[model samples]
Target chain A: MTTSRRQHTLEVLVENEPGVLARVAGLFSRRAFNIETLNVGPTEDSSISKMVIGVAVEGHSLEQVIAQLDKLVSVISIKDVTGKVKEVHDTQPDYQN
Target chain B: MAHIPTANGTAMTGATSLVKSLEAADVEVMFGLPGGAILPAYDPIFDSSIRHILVRHEQGAGHAATGYAQVTGRAGVCIATSGPGATNLVTPLMDAAMDSVPLIAITGQVPSAAIGTDAFQEADIRGITMPFTKHNYLVTDPDQIPGVIAEAFHIATTGRPGPVLVDVAKDALQKMTTFNWPTSIKLAGYNPKTTPDAQAITDAAALIAQSSKPVFYVGGGVIKANAHKELRQLVELLGAPVVTTLMARGAFPDSHPLHMGMPGMHGTVAAVTALQKADLLITLGARFDDRVTGKLSTFAPNAKILHADIDPAEIGKNRHADVAVVADVKETISALIPALKAALAKNQPDLSAWLRQMNSLKSTYPLGFDQPEDGSLSPQHVIQRIGQISGTDTIFTAGVGQHQMWASQFISYEHPRTWLNSGGAGTMGYGVPAAMGAKVGAPDATVWAIDGDGCFQMTNQELVTCALNNIPIKVAIINNESLGMVRQWQTLFYEGRYSNTNLESKRVPNFPMLAESMGCVGLSCERPEDLDKTIEKAMSINDQPVVVDFRVHRDAMVWPMVAAGTSNDEIMIARATAPDWDSQEL
Candidate 1:
């Protein structure tokens, strides 16, 4: 198990419903996982919402967090898109944000 | 069958719809108490087919529901009003969550407009129970009641079952709505993997094939998944020792040769030693709880872990799994059996030496208790007698403390769901009500609540519910007249200060009289000679609930102790005597 802490960005897709964010936020708080930044917005499918969560944690702890997140009935999918964005930015310079 | 207009087209109150939804879900019984906010729902329940057991307290309702669920392998239903009523359910909900009992709690809430304002009898139970429950809902719209009820039951009974709460606003219950049971439920985010990964199964099989000494550390999940049959088959196939945890007292039969007794702080010497010295730990449905593992870092230091559970988060929460299989235990064992048989065909491992060593340890330090120095009746003796007389068909429930441990130790459990307790949460008052619920679920089976004096007083009022409702459960109060477990701790670690642990039970509230007042047959026994006769008398009284108060020694403690925060290697056979681990050769 990797013990060194590193910054990881997790993109969680969830059902757009009342208290969905609270459920996600509550999981982090109850598990004592510190959230650096969290942002949520509606996706192309209006019924679905995407949440980008940033936290500095060990790889093992991050795995645990993802597993716990997967338990929520509202959460659709979770992906650690930490380095993928960087790779895409380096490969396509013409594609600007 | 022709559908009634009330089923779909005709509009009815949400409360009536709720009852219809429950009927559609096949809920035959529910335990609850009615208050102001929940009065509307109770109105419909009067005419419904479902049997509602009116409990004295909301906590009783919750635990009764849990007990019902555990024995029947169905989702138990409980109901309560908002605010204090809902808050009272917190402990039982948490207990059910920790132990993974399938339970549904339907609570009445204040009006939607009064939710944030903290109106009379208002509480945010949905938010309060968020951390503990599997899922929760706050329903304001009357139209959503039917669908939500169906969804709650589905979520509660499936994949690592736990409690689910649906708090409906009072206005919703009063409003007119059409009831329509959903043909199916589709929760997009919730899909549990029942099939084990082929590679993981192969890896586990290979590990089992090579290991000379392996132990099956079983937990409550085995019972929850109803995988005890597969568990026995796998254990026999591998020719390995099996140690059931406190939560899994009967997953493996006590009479079986491969079965070592329960393993934990107060577990048997053979079981604890097996885990401490094993080469491999095949943990099924059981997480490595601190109580079971002792000190995490030092627990089973020589063994590699192969963990399988339905809940993914439990895999590496406390101890890292060398090979983790995320699937239902029943499915895991079913798949692993064939793979392990194939692996054993190529490489047959000899386990005679390991088995011999375990049997030797088992004989050397058997589970037995000495008569108290004070000459008072022994709690162990009473409990053992109760088990012996009641026979195998009985369902035993326990409250937490020395009696709980003794019940686990002395009672010979050969079947799953025969033993129920508040294992994870260790709620003291779980026994009486849980037994009440278990009796309600299994009407023909004899149900016994082996409780401590401290624990009995907490929820003994449920006896009234039992007597009035014709749920005849027998209660055996091991009256030590003090908080026995806490007093044991005081004796061992606190220099026998005693402090506030004493309950003075003998002096205050005569148990037999109290039982009689509650419409139960109250029996009391002080001498060892009277124990069996008293138990027999209690057993004969099937018409009414029975409470047997057996006065026992207060100083008596649970043995085979590994002190809190210590290593399993440091387990003591008695008060100060450690087992001769070096002398035993594997």
Candidate 2:
């Protein structure tokens, strides 16, 4: 049975460096994951950057997405804040044509 | 804190420090080829305790390293020069990644200044290997060498083992710096969960108890986690029929009554049927690979899966798990045993009918092929005879083909790490070098490379390396004189228009002569009666490598095959009543 797609916002902390964002985006695209929206910037700690990524996934895919994201060496941590973040922040993901 | 070249307590080349760090990691053996870029790294080998095996080709180094890692459960190290050297290592690295083998590939890059200027023998080693590696590093700074090596080893060996590459620039090896080996890494992004959630375990146990037709589907993760003992316990406790994947051949003892052999595209009818009919699939460390799950939509339609794997990506990749337990397979099995026992004590599900059904399938459609009355040798028979003659502790590696499937079907692996093959990648030319590497890792174990004739031609030059190094691994080339697997496909699906599958020539290179020329014993078995003696002679010579070419039937095909994208339920067993496509008018 197909589970309804739920929109989830995840805040990912990663090392600030070249190709870090590309690595993150590459993983999502390779796995064929539907990214709703993504925003990136430097955190309070300049050495680390924070990426707020919004994606619509099934209940089963939520764990997989988080797990796959966590596998990146550049990614520091990821937290799912679906309800915590306002839905207004979500935008159409760039990769979806 | 052993310093590299502490002459007046200062100055050391980057290569010396690199060797020092590798020693710190207790790397016993390194398989590699040297070139202009990596020449500096070769200088320190004379001073270091590590044994360097110079391979004929760079690809051999990668496969040999993989073989060592598979058996030793440690990161096998291989080195290569830049450009073509690095590119050659690609197949093995990708193969290692696919199989989750722990391996570390070190490639020397062009001088820091010369990089990306189209310098001779310059390649983007790090960028080339980025997709498949667990992690990688391009170290332009000599100071980071020790830490990078440490991290590479740590990452390669831990939590779903895989290949990691460290591409060191030439200047890094030529320049001097003090060595400081980082004892631990603080990678915030790379923590692997080793413990299963308590609730997930409880849920899995409840599902296990409630289901009547349950099957324990095991894979390579059990062996990697050293959970075979726990696996056996779970099997005995539940009394459920167990089906091992191609990678999980030796993970479970096949002699046990409940063992139902392999389950997949070329698996036994009993194993394939059991999974299709199972109500619950307790998957331990095995992914639902497409080969195993033929026509995914119809695969195990009735079964609710409980997946226990350390790698979370594998959990929901193909089939959605009812309970996904992310932990080391050994630990997960250890936790599940007690919970499973508790559930059973509360109420045992009736499995007598299921057991009866399994037995009936096993007896009715047992794995077998037609034996010609003309007394020609069959590849399956050759494998069986080898199993009988060779010691119980023998390790077998096979190149991919009909021979690989035949070896899997015929060989009974009693212990973990005893059966090594390239399952996920289905890589040909893997048997020779991999067996040599396995032999190097475990010198006492009798290692045999069960290769197809076509595959043996790919990397059999490694036999020279084996013979010279005194790595006496037996190689049995199932010489069907054709690419047997593809020929079988062409025969069945492509209207028997065999396209370049036949390798026959007027003067076929004498395998025995070739082996003898390579400084090893060579033998051949043409008749069925001579098979026992030839294998016995091959097994007796333990000092150096031996190659045996067994001429078998060219037209033989693997049975109980689930054609690609076809339903598992529609497994074809007998050849007498062929499929409709074969009999169709062209």
TM-scores, one per candidate: 0.97, 0.93
Q: What does candidate 1's lDDT look like per residue over B1-586, in tens digits?
A: 1223247655899999999888888899999999988889999899999999999999999999999999999999999999999999999999999999999999999988888996998889998999999999999999999889888988898899999999999999999997777777888998988888999999999999999999999999999999999999999999899999999998999999888899989999999999999999999999898899999889999999999999999988988888999999999999999999999999999999999999999988889999977677999999999999999889999999999999999999999999999999999999999999999899999999999999998999899999999999999999999999999999999999999999999888799999999999999999987888999999999999999999998788899999999999999988899998778995
Fnat of candidate 2 is 0.63
lDDT of 2 by residue, A19-94 (tens): 6877788788777888879999988999899999998885447888998888887888889887766644355444
TM-scores for chain B, listed for all candidates: 0.98, 0.96
lDDT of 1: 0.92
Off by over 4 Å in 2: A1-10, A33-40, A52-63, A80-97, B1-11, B576-586
Best by lDDT: 1
After superposing candidate 1 on the true structure, give the runs of residues whose Cα lies further than 4 Å from its correct spot.
A1-4, A58-60, A85-97, B1-6
* Per-candidate total of colliding backbone pairs: 0, 0
